[model samples]
Target: MSCFEILDPAFGRFVLGNAALKQLATGFDWVEGPVWFGDAGCLLFSDIPNDKILRYTPGVGISTYRAPSNYSNGHTRDRQGRLVSCEHGTRRVTRTELDGSITVIADSYQGKSLNSPNDVVVKSDGSIWFTDPHYGIGSNYEGFAADQELPCNVYRIDPDGTIEAVLTDFNCPNGLAFSPDETLLYVADTGRMYQDDPAHIRRFSMESGRPKSLGIFHTIAPGKGDGIRCDMDGNLWSSAGDGVHCIAPDGHLMGKILVPEKVSNICFGGRAKHQLYITATTSLYAITLNRVGAQTP
Candidate 1:
């Protein structure tokens, strides 16, 4: 009964073979984003179809952080420890201020409405990066059903409040993360969700405000790449239909942590930032790992 499926020797050393996988909570409708707040001693995740954000504290169990969450999908914390989120129902990105107020990061570009903000990450420099896809608008289950008005792409919100489409040619951008030093960006395209499209992750070098594409990093088959994160050693951890896949810094599949449900997102948290929190269909699960995320708690 190993907790991990080690596909590479390096990954065997990366994950504890005996560390048990724990299900923290259940009974949610489609959990997608999971972010750990070490300062608050709790983990926050979205139950998208329910349009709510649930907080899971070790002793207190699960509670509502925010109801009517605008169908938030992805979340991350800025360097200042503020909450940055992507709202699928609202088709916009938002930031929760210290005073508990919400600031709109971006909802439109060039006078055109965004499709739906999906996954997001914050750079050390305070710039906000997020994916825009039509998944939310494709139906009324997770969001208000409406017509899409923009291409499926990834965007960057500048520190000064300017918004620009950094990657414009995605079939369906779903997940994104930065390399350990912020020199490289990894974005996943789950085009396979439709018409046998390529389900792969792409790499880019961040330069000149418009990053240069390094090319496809890895092509996933029989599954698709969803929410993703980078470890301190620069390995990319991605969500798949089967479980969580760990790919090497050089784009080789290293290993996987198999979950019973389809995994949507992942984050590194817990007291030591060595806990890998996973968001699956209707549950939140965690396992202790020997690695740390690129961003610290």
Candidate 2:
């Protein structure tokens, strides 16, 4: 069967190649939140249902990076090269220091515990941003059942260890990332948790260390996106049920890389930042792309 195709039409000829969709690992409940560590030459992702974080290398396959990971959902590297994670089970954002020690960056705001940290990103200025929804507390599936006392919001943790709310009033915030220039922020509204439709990606202008002038970017699948990243050219790569959709900066659908299972999250890594690692349901996949990823930190 053919897995590659190049379309010729009135617009132009665009090539869609399946150069990498092989499953390197399997037998997980649900996989999400992939991040690339070029220095370590490996990819790390969260398997929420399994309550673990897994690491994958080209030749070594998959290995346990962390267990009882507090049901971490999203991950990214900080400007200082530390691992920043959003913990659903713990209802907080955490970081892993160089010595393998964990630090709670943000857990409670205004003396009340957060709902559930879903996704996270670190700006070039060393500010850690993350999303909080009730996914972790709504049920006992991903995290412990607890009372949600605050509105769903996005927060920024400053270098001095201060947490500031950036945006509030979202049904549920899922995937998120800053543009290559760090001037714009994108977030996926995967509303209605595990349902169809009502799925849209939104964009906000980042100014003076906050988000402003929010708007819609694009929509994905019968479901919404989970994790998101940007390429060097400013194009967005988002996780979708069908595969990974590469959308242009202007919100045009360019093409897709198909996966046998539904994709939950993705990140760019490899020696040249040209590799796209995908976290799909029950498996992990990767491909070498022609473009580099943005240096968020």
Best by TM-score: 1
Model 2 has a clash total of 0
- Using all chains and alpha carbons, the TM-scores for the candidates as numbered come to 0.97, 0.92
| Candidate 1, pairs of clashing residues | none
Task: Give lDDT tens digits, candidate 2, residues 133-188.
Answer: 78889888888888888878888899999998878867888888999889999988
Model 2: worst 10 consecutive residues (lDDT sum): 5-14
lDDT of model 2 at position 133? 79
Q: Pick the candidate with the highest lDDT.
A: 1
Q: Can you list the residue pairs that collide in candidate 2? A: none
For candidate 1, write residues 90-193 as lDDT tens digits: 89999999999999999998999898899999988888999998889888998998987889989988899988888999999999999998889999998723
* lDDT value, residue 136 of candidate 2: 86
Which ranges in model 2 have alpha carbons more than 4 Å from their true place? 1-18, 194-197
